[model samples]
Target: MYGGVAAVKELSLIVCRGEFLTILGPSGSGKTTALMLLAGFISPTNGDILVGGKSVASVPSYRRDQGIVFQSYALFPHLSVRRNLEFPLEMRGVKAAERADRVANLLARVHLDNFGDRMPSQLSGGQQQRVALARALIADPPVLLLDEPLGALDRNLREQMQSEIKTLHKEFGITTVCVTHDQEEALTLSDRIIVMRGGAIEQIDTPEGLYDRPKSLFVANFLGEANLLNGVIPLPNDATPTSMLSIIRPERIRLAVPHAPTLADAHQRQQANGVVTEVIYAGALRKYNVQVGNNVLIMREHVASDQQVFRPGDQVRLDWLRSDVRLVATETNNGVE
Candidate 1:
């Protein structure tokens, strides 16, 4: 009903005290809307959202006692770092002496103690973001919400801040929910991740659960790169398990050398023979597009000091453990949309 789109539909979520949860999805996938609902910025069309076992359906945003850090640093440019950190305390009317003590502690916590006198414009992007985080935590709110707080920084700085934010969450033990479209960031920061799509909840699990055992095709493809093999389920054998569909990850697929030990001979016949079509060097890993009959499958492996190099237009045999090929429900159409 908001943003001219059905932002969230039939969404129910609960967060325990002091848990780090992340809402992750692509743009327009309703991640931010869900965050807004929890933060009391927008009301839900249906269903109730509870915080700490209490319903906050009609709670006003200001009274929610939640701290939020936005994608943009959203710092007051005219205010010095110290003033910015103290602004929340000032509004809350904490005693000046106590405010100073809290400010000093926070400055040390965020590693911005000496830069407190500088204005927002004077600090670099990373420093400004740290200040924003410090300001949000100033009030010691029950819950912390972050909306793509690292989106503006360069990649290197963004990675660094990710660790800092994670450390802060652990140190403060505050229940936190972060919204981001970045999968890697979500996997890095969240104890549990909620994957959303088309105003609906797709999957909610620990990072490894979402990646290793996705419930649906949408979840499999959205969380990471998956080589969805479009093949009918083979009957259960001594080696193969009976299922409807197979979901293979690129990194799980392996290449075999002719003279090397055979997986089938080793009682590991979970292998597929394919022809290599394209090779891509991705710095840390090598990606290969392999053609298995009419299906093009992806394979990935880490860069090795003495790695075997393969080029396009070479026939290669790909093998994997039967356990690695996850059996997923077969659908008539891929659920990408």
Candidate 2:
């Protein structure tokens, strides 16, 4: 909470041992504040934080022993990579010989073995980030906290660092909590993710769970591209359509070429007739935007070696498996289903 405004409210979460949990949200959503609370940099307004069954809500930041990597890398510009890696050890009163050994081991671990003599300014962005991670881990902390750690790098470097970070997590087997606004990053890095909105937990589940079975409209729209149909969806063999919201992923939707038999085969699946409004090509996949009954839905499909491609102004039918339609609560203030 800040300035008497509730940043996070009625929040309770569990991070499993040795699990990588990511807190994903946009700016001003309180993900970073929650991270600070867990790191002991700030105390919760009225809650307890437990690590291994011990409550540490009031513990000081220095005593938490959780290694944190910030978005800025936060390396000592004047210090060589070796000294930067050694600072934490020195703070813990580790002897010179042990510090040297630990530094060497971490240098090798982060694949910066011969770069220790160089200053942070001399290394590339990715190299310096690796050093930051190495320094965080050199102290042998049980938990790792990362706050948008890849937000500073270029796209290519970000992807590379993501792979490196995942490798490190697998190798170290440490419980990790990362905060980021990037949906792709959360899906790629986290074993499970906590999606935050309005300073509160909107949803908490595995990446697949959140994507495939989102409980709310906000979640459905946030996790990926979703085509939402308002009002009741018409169920086959039912007389009346149920009043609610329905979601279908772009990829789950399939496009069928217009044929005379389509009307006769309508009973087999949920089908809608639409005119193609746009086509997008992106190497491996193609996206089609279709306009149907005052609604525009996007259908994404992989481009097979010998697949037929549809263009704008083409008449086509969009269909999906009955089970692919997910029902959601229509009212925004209503509790999630």
TM for candidate 2 is: 0.92
Every model's TM-score: 0.92, 0.92
Question: For residues 1-337, could you state the per-residue lDDT of candidate 2 as single tens digits?
Answer: 6788877766799899999999998787789888988998888889899998999999999988889999999999999999999999999999999999999999999999999899998999899899989988999898999989999999999999999999999999999999999899999999999988777888899999999998777888888888975532454343223545678999998888877355544575687789999999998989999998789999999999887788899999888777788876443432333
> What lDDT, from 0 to 1, does candidate 2 have?
0.87
Local distance difference test values of all predictions, in order: 0.84, 0.87
CA displacement after TM-score superposition, residue 73 of candidate 2 (Å): 0.5
How many clashes show up per model?
0, 1
lDDT of 1 by residue, 51-164 (tens): 777889889888888899998889998899999988889888999999999999999999998998998989999999999999999899999999999999999999999999
Question: Cα lDDT for residue 327, model 1?
Answer: 61
- Runs in model 2 with CA error above 4 Å? 231-243, 260-268, 331-337
Clashes of 2: 1
